[model samples]
Target: MAEQGAAERGPDGLSRRRLLAASAAGGAVWLLRGTVGPESARAIGTAPVLPGGLVPYQQVYENWAGEIRTSPLWVCAPDSPQQVADLADWAAANGWRLRAQGQRHGWAPFTVAAGTPADTRVLLVDTTRSLTALSLASGFGGAGGRAVRAQTGASLEDLLAFLADQGLGVAACPAPGDLTVGGALAVGGHGTAVPAAGETPRPGQGFGSLSNQVLSLTAVVHDASAGRYVLRTFDRSEADAAAFLVHLGRAFLTEVVLRAAPDTRLRCLSRVDVPATELFAAPGSPAAGGGRTFADFLASTGRVEAIWFAFTDHPWLKTWQPAPDKPLFAHEVSAPYNYPFSDNLPQPVAELAGQLVSGSEQLAPVFGQLQFLITKIGLTGDVTDLLLAPGLLRSLLSGDTLTHLLAGGLRSDLWGASRHLLQYVRPTTLRVTANGYAIHCRRSDVQWVVSRFASSYQQVLATHQARGEYPMNGAAEIRVTGLDDPVACGVPGAQPPLLSALRPHADHPEWDTAVWLDLLTLPGTPGLHAFYREIEQELLGLFDGTRAGLRVEWSKGWAYTTDAAWADPAVLGRTVPATLRAPGAPGWDEAVATLDGYDPARVFGNPFLDALLR
Candidate 1:
């Protein structure tokens, strides 16, 4: 590989370009921000003086994938919850909207829309700065079970670690640890898990999203008598609190008290030998060969994830089983991000990824194979040539490359506290653009759902491949979890998250599980949006209301057209609300009306949210 000379090289032998490519594929925070110098970064424009002596700064706003960027945006970090309420009142008075920002790790234009004008009357309230106070709720054992009160800006890593220290933890959480508690709850983020065989869920242990664990939340809402936005606390049982549980950026939550259970050790095992065909096989089809299908694992442990690399025969399967004590053969880990190879890219993988992203669209298959090989070698420490053809192996890997990648310990089987295994993906994993959805179906139809979707995905890829169009060079990730059952929160009369993707369909009471599917790809791949649109349409049509329903994962990409995401009017106007709840029905209508009632001025909305959430 040619480089720009040693001047652009890092301390390692790899060039900066190779390092960047590797980072883009794995560990870097994919972003492009404004280049304004610090001297003027804090320069206030025509904004009125903020309350609490807060000085707003001119900053660039960009989402995780750099797909949404706005420059010269005014942002501020408040010191207290009262300051946020004051800021909201100021925004309403000054004809400006306020959007709460935390880590900015989401895909959808929930925070700020693409092509937002530099002079847009939107003020971004950054919560990660100083409003991250956390503490245990008083009288933790009353009726709500064990609980912790954390400010919205507190990171999941910190909150989970705090619970772990006290011998308490939530049953499930998102893989990334950097996500804000506020952001995760607001979007209904979830992890892969459900009840295994005859297992019982302990009190406060919910199989649904983080929002389902909320005991109470404090938010800045309108106070009719006060005639301004004021901090208000809402218990889980309140009708309005149901709307606030997963507001989708339509409201600002300053703090929340969440239910937690006693922490249990977990044993996570990884394997790369499961052929996708057999693993995703139909429920009772002989092609399954009575093999270890996705449903088989789901029934056994209830905690499983399948990562199938594009154009690959085998998918990486990880199953986490509850282990009260560490298994004798399991490697004990103390912290999260046990998969080092995934967090950091190897040289060969980085080089090929650079070429692929640089316009060698034909290299997509090769890149996919390389990624699978890396996982196989990293997980099981298998360096045998049998994994790849001799010619391709000789071309892509050498003794030097193997040595560089094998420096880390094998993570095939790991046993540790729940936090260590539950949060494995670090901020550095491949930052690809993803289109996400949740297919609701009976728990018995897990394999059926997986098989149908996988089959459609393969046909779509084959069609694109026949035309030499490789819009996806990444993988398809699938996981299964239970729906948001409010009983798990232990709050009597508590309503489910109205906007959560895992919210059980009111009409289909038997559909208990949610199959989460996300298709990942490099951000700028040609024909990507069209490819995604085809998949989205196929999914919506396939799942209709017959036996399953499809709901858009609010945090990721969706409503795709030929060129952009969140742009399909038909989807936003008709399909989405209809899927969640019948149009003009209670679930959709109630949430919208409540949110509108709280912020009648729409001071908490952006253009995109106003359109989709209307």
Candidate 2:
């Protein structure tokens, strides 16, 4: 990776992108620009005055899992939308390419990639600083929720916290709060929500990925009339707006209006007694399991997630239900990241991961079982609050709270606001490489999807274990979501997000639900890539390319090879495009063409994106 000072000019030796990565120190002020620390190898050329101060590129960029690394020419942090427009225009006028970097939490190369030098004239836009704006609409009369406007750089945690203060909440959100709005939407990040048992979706929003809530977005695009890159707002009503809605990072969004609802109280329960064989049984297997099956939970609550520890019989099942008020036996919480055992990486687990990554590949199973035991203890230990330390709990309450603990009449249910409970895992917690896929199928077929996939997953793992190739480190996650409704955009004639994993199946309208499946393992673990490839093959094999199919969870790892992620040429060049171009699915070629029209010079693209869009 190349390192250099900020460019005072464009690629033609002028100030195009005053790119500067945001510093963790002294956030909002952003007065002291990032100077070239010891890592930067080159100095940026001479430049004119830019909005953000020019300094050497000193930031060392690493993805969340520390799997990918790259040094960009400059980390440009624009203070305003106008500044962004100017920088983009100048970059195009020259020959430099720009890639936006949010929290640097994602595995994909959408922003910047390893082995790419900074001197290649590429700029990484750090939006976390000045771009943190969150505003709510006022003076509107409607049955729907309020429309909130947020900048692309706002972290989900900050955005969620602000919304909590405003008495508003979102439909669904990923677990980590450190995820940036731009990065999340660029990759269609989602959480579990499927209309929660007859609850109607708001007029201006739907129960899908974070992207479906978008009403209008502003981005820097080439304007022939203006003869330069300028800030342009696209409403859902426009045809081309569909392209920007989910352009796979091919286009950039500065700010967007997201529809939000009044905050609601939620109850979350953790169940760890269900066996994998019964919980994930075939769609119509049998009713003899005695206990409720995964399908039963989905039908009853509509919000369920199954996290099965590899090689373990009882997978942890989490079910969330709408509780208008505190239940008789509910525990109360006011903040997030409540799961201490998960939010902060455990020392033993970290050691296991270190060993697994260091070449003790056979220890994968042992590490996974240990993790499962810790989770069980985390949920049911003497202090059920998993997070509350013994000393702190005793200090908070000396008598009644302590006596109740002794009596064993402690609470059984967790009661908290949606925002607080929905966001429990903090960033840098349990950093590991993972593969994710969302399978769209009929709600009735969810059991089949889960059962079949689980069966195939276990079979593959066992076959590999026989060959001494321990590829799994324990748990797999399963979640569900409703298809994105077109009307959610609030545009008179808008369509659903073109590339969202929850996008509907055109032919079989009954296929409106999606089952999200994910496989997790320690990064750099031997045989992980090949192991994930086998799982990917199993998932794709079960879909059959008809009424049911699979879409990659873009923000996460995918396109697996024997040794690395995003390295499968066939999956990139053919599988993804062909799947998107299926009979019922919308036009892939058309979306690519529309995006190309938006930025003729490919200003916001990279080699990986070019392959997918091409």
- Please, what are the lDDT tens digits per residue for candidate 1 over residues 1-614? 45546643432344444544756465442443443422473544565478888887777787766567675677888999999999988988888889998988889998888667768888888899998988888754664559999999999999999999888898889999989999998899999999998889877799999999998999999888999999999988897899999999999999999999988899999998778988999877886767599998888898999999998899999999999998888999999999887887666676676666555778889888888888888888897743555566556766866775677888999999999999987777766789999999999988999999999999999999999999999999999889998888887788898888888777888999999999998766778999999999999989998988899999999999999899999999999988778543358878999999999998989878888888
Name the regions of candidate 2 deviating beyond 4 angstroms. Answer: 1-56, 138-143, 201-205, 287-291, 382-412, 582-586
* Local distance difference test, candidate 1: 0.85
Which predicted model would earn the best TM-score?
Answer: 1
Candidate 1 stretches greater than 4 Å from native: 1-48, 385-387, 390-395, 582-585
Residue-by-residue lDDT tens digits, candidate 2, 1-614: 12223432212221111111111111121122235632435445432233345332545466775566554346667788787777777678787777787887788888777657656667677789889899886533242678788999999998888888988887678988888998898888889977666766544446788888877789889898878888899876677777777777898889988878777888888877678888998755674255477888887887889998887777888888778798877788788776665554443455455556555678777666666655665665443432443453234333543343334322225888988778876653676678988898888788888888988988998898898888788579999987777766555677777777777667667788889998887665677888888888778889965758898988777898888888899998888776666584556777898888879999989888887789
lDDT score at residue 239, model 2, on the 0-100 scale:
73
Per-model TM-score on C-alpha atoms: 0.94, 0.87
